[model samples]
Target: MTVTLAADSGRLPEYPMELDSAQSQRVERLLAGTVISLHDHPIRLPDPLTAETWKLHSGQSADVFGGDAIVRSGLNVVLASALAEPDQRRLLSWAAAMRPQLLGPELSGAESLALAMRGEGSAVLLALEDLGSIGTDLVGIEELYRAGFRSAGLVYNTGNALGGGLGQSTDGGLTEPGRRAVAMLNDLHMLVDLSHVGDRTSIEAAALSTAPVVISHAGARSLWPSARMKPDDVLRAVADTGGVIGIEAAPGSTRVSADTTHDLDAVMAHVEYVAELVGVDHVGLGPDTFFGDHTQLYSAAGWSPQPVPGYERLALPDYVAGMENPAEAPRNAASWLVRRGWSDADIAKVLGANAARVLESVLR
Candidate 1:
């Protein structure tokens, strides 16, 4: 479905914040902490529909977040589609081959910790947005784990052999195969994310998984009411499992109202809502952002901005200000919390510690 673009498709205002001296000081202090992003596509993505083959924008992945305090980032393979076609499979095959070279060195859990302890940033841990690339086979999952992916989602926005997705008109929830897949992921120590899964599927996966289950990059459905956002019950289920819901800042996905400017303020509203609903410990930053105009990418790929059954469609911003890309989101998001008078300890948890605790447990 083609989502009609709003009139103002030009770049939205940048950084749109004016912090006082005290708040500026607080932001600086927060930047010194162990910031971690639970989900982000740090690398630039080419339009999958237009590209003949998979290719990323030219840059070393490590340099993408240069000097940022984000010690760990959950890098997801966002382009991996749920389609079972020969051309798509070929694209995925090429991506899998290029993974090692694109991401540089793979750091084990201990190695990453040691690096963080030494004040050097930790290596990026890879995750799959969904298990679509692997179909229903355990061997395919094992291959990905061997390739250094420590986290995965059961389904993307649509159904797979494993289960139904949020994009499906009718969700049948998890299948017997999906339950088996969840168990295998638990046994393999892979972190489970339910960001784009159907509501019933998400709740069931969280209940069945032995490990903590995250909605790695989404917001509260009650706040924005998008299909991409999680409902209260889903959020409760994840929190019950001691998991974190990483608040996302993707343009139009996390707005407070249909007409609200899709900016850092909009992103923070969802953060505040989730933190209040499930405690600060159960919230973190995901900011599934990249280095380019995300709306343009969606337009090029013929993708609609995620909308639910009842809610009015969100007006897309050219970019979500201050949270436009991975480079700016961490500090800007933390700074927004500071500006909101959130306690330092709470801000720390929301920014990184909460995610670190869950990720470390499963990755260990």
Candidate 2:
């Protein structure tokens, strides 16, 4: 279904909404604290619609934050997504065992956050695409938490022993181990995430977990009904737990057509939808994509490994306006919110305060 712009707000705006000094300072501070999902690490995205895969090239990924030297510093904090179990382990090792080696003279902010989630300066927070890697056991979770692993999604797009993913035929809620996992995470002060879990799993996970659960990267289904988007009722459930839903900037995920997907307004529409659905406090940025190759750097989401009914036409585009990369995302959001006349405090919540709230509340 094509998303029609509000009657009074016809057509996408020509973007990069300018910000005054005070607004600029607020945005800069948000970026320094937690920008979320810079896609700092590698991810394999298969786009069946265009048959072109999505991978953030090395040089380009660094360029999104700044240059290689300032990349780690430019992004104060980011949630790095590792899909497989091994990938998750490797990320932990890189941030802990090899952090000093990776940057001999300059230590990464990830190290600081590893020491303290609300610690000094910037850092990269570790998270997983799903619980595919770590077995649903307390011992393994304990080891990961000791190793600086912060948060994780129960499933990606496939149902596992933990529970059903968004791609599952039916969700039966959390498995026995899944229940244990939620309790264990809470006890350990680790974050519980319900990003791509099935509807039943999403509801059950939020209800069962003692800690707040986050939908790290997803759009609002009410705004645009994609398999990857969550509905209002579901978002309210997350909000009730004091959890946040980071609106994604992936192609098709934002409900924009092929023509306008490259424009920034498409991305802002989802942000506006979430702020309207719940409130700005429950809204945040999670551009589960990065800047690369194409000048506009538009990326598409093949929501599942299998075809999602009615969502099988997300062809890659030339650019994605506000979210060409992480650096520009907050700026774009601040601009859009300013246009809508949102207050500085509200914009700050949508920027990163909400994310920090979850981490500070849930993380040990």
lDDT value, residue 35 of candidate 1:
73
Give a tens-digit lDDT track for model 1, residues 57-128: 222222122213232222111212122222334434544654564344666644564465455644566666
- When summed lDDT is taken over every stretch of 10 residues in candidate 1, the lowest stretch is 75-84
Off by over 4 Å in 1: 1-14, 45-104, 310-314
* TM-score of every candidate: 0.83, 0.75
What local distance difference test score does each model get?
Answer: 0.71, 0.62
Candidate 2 local lDDT, 252-343, one digit each (tens): 56654534554567777888888888887898878775434232233233333334366567555545666655555666676677667777
The TM-score of predicted model 1 comes to: 0.83
RMSD, each candidate, Å? 5.9, 8.2
